[model samples]
Target: MILRAFLFLIVVWTLPAMGPWQDCEGAKACDLDGRSYHIRVPDDWDGDTALPVLLHFHGWGRQGDLIVKHQRISGHTRRRGVLLIAPNGRGRTWDFWDQGSADVPFAAAVIEDVAKRFPIDRDQIFVSGYSYGAAMAWRFACENGDGVTGLLAVSGTLRQTERCPQAPKHIRHVHGFADTVMDFPMGAGGDVTHPVALWRKALGCAAGRRLPEWQVVSFLSFERWHWDNCEGGHTVTLDLHSGGHFIPHGWIGWQLDQLMGRVPLYP
Candidate 1:
């Protein structure tokens, strides 16, 4: 199955080859500021299925391809039934919130545009990212989680929770304990807020125990933490033990599949 999927991506990449989506047989694009996002077309895409959608944001110096490449490519219209979108940043690094209101608007534009063009299910819309990209996800979640089911925030810190909106929504955070760039103990002090603690407080799960459930990828120890009893809803943390800023292979696919529930596995 892995070989087939790998070959499938290989075939996709071989076509019209530009960025990773050069051969994305089911992709579309929008060029702005010289940046292009190669969107994938689900094998089962009917243009009216009201399926779910995922907005994938990349970290600093990264783009949509980084997220798409890691996604479980499906010839079907959706993955696990959800339509996934990997939006490239005009600046190669997204500013979903921060001071770059322009980027945020651009992101919002992409979300709306895709939903309009595809049969995206409104209730299951989701956003996810890594490192700086995670920071951007938090920004969006803080501002838009009301519309989204939840956020798959990974390997980065949040901005000052104090400056964030008054009420937060369902949030799933995945952080690495040994991340030197964004350490667990530094809570925004390391340029990114210590996400887990703040999220726990916000979710009203500030007292949950730290459960270690994870895996090792490329010799790096990684794990996830959980904090139940959230205020608005439920929340989980994919805490990486010795993980770094990069997203591991297995978890990425799992996340995409898990959230895109009912979406057929990428064929």
Candidate 2:
């Protein structure tokens, strides 16, 4: 069931505070740099506890609203009690590759604004994206590692640049070996090796160790390469899947399980 990809934007302000949590269910407006980003919060939140937040970016020409509808993200956010912030790109595309893109500053502001309005765990902030959005995710995680707890990039890789962030962080990149749109090994869609090498070098890892087990979910199977014993709890992982350009079913849960240290279900 391939869902149509559409991207959106929203801007929001603080809402009326309830007993313990603010009622932030459904779509709301979030203002950053005079632009509005549409954000979704779960209604079932207890309001008293600080929850992790995920900033999800859509692929090029896709809207934030469409990502929630198509990416199976809303269900994940609801069940995980995660605050989701999906911001639209200026022209349905993010300028993250450009060193001077305003999207970076806007993203930083959005995080701050969300924290001010909700009970968000600052230390557990996450960023994720697909395709072009995936590139943006890498850019953000690379440049602002200190502010991000982890990042997940699908079907894309980081843009070549002068330098990478010195801060240690966790990173996961998932790519389909059969992808044709982004072209798995070449083309604009980044291959797994370069990004992994980039981070390994930055983290001073002489080599990456291979995981003992391969993970599988339905028709999707992946093997992992991990950089170990890096400074500052920094971990770099690359999961190469035997699939295509589209996001596979259960992909979100699979990555989340990895993040939470839960084993992926194998068949």
Q: Model 2, 39-85: lDDT tens per residue? A: 66654766568878888888999878776555466566656667788
TM-score of each: 0.71, 0.81
lDDT of each: 0.59, 0.69
Compute the lDDT of residue 76 as modeled in candidate 1. Answer: 25
User: In model 2, how large is the Cα lDDT of residue 212?
Assistant: 63
Candidate topping lDDT: 2
**Clash statistics: count for each candidate:** 25, 18
**After aligning candidate 2 to the native by TM-score, how far in Å is the CA of 203 from where it should be?**
1.4
53-163, model 1: which lDDT tens digit per residue?
Answer: 667777788667655555423222244556667777766876654543566666777777665455567777777777777777777766556677767777765654434
Question: What's the CA RMSD for each of the models?
Answer: 8.6, 9.6
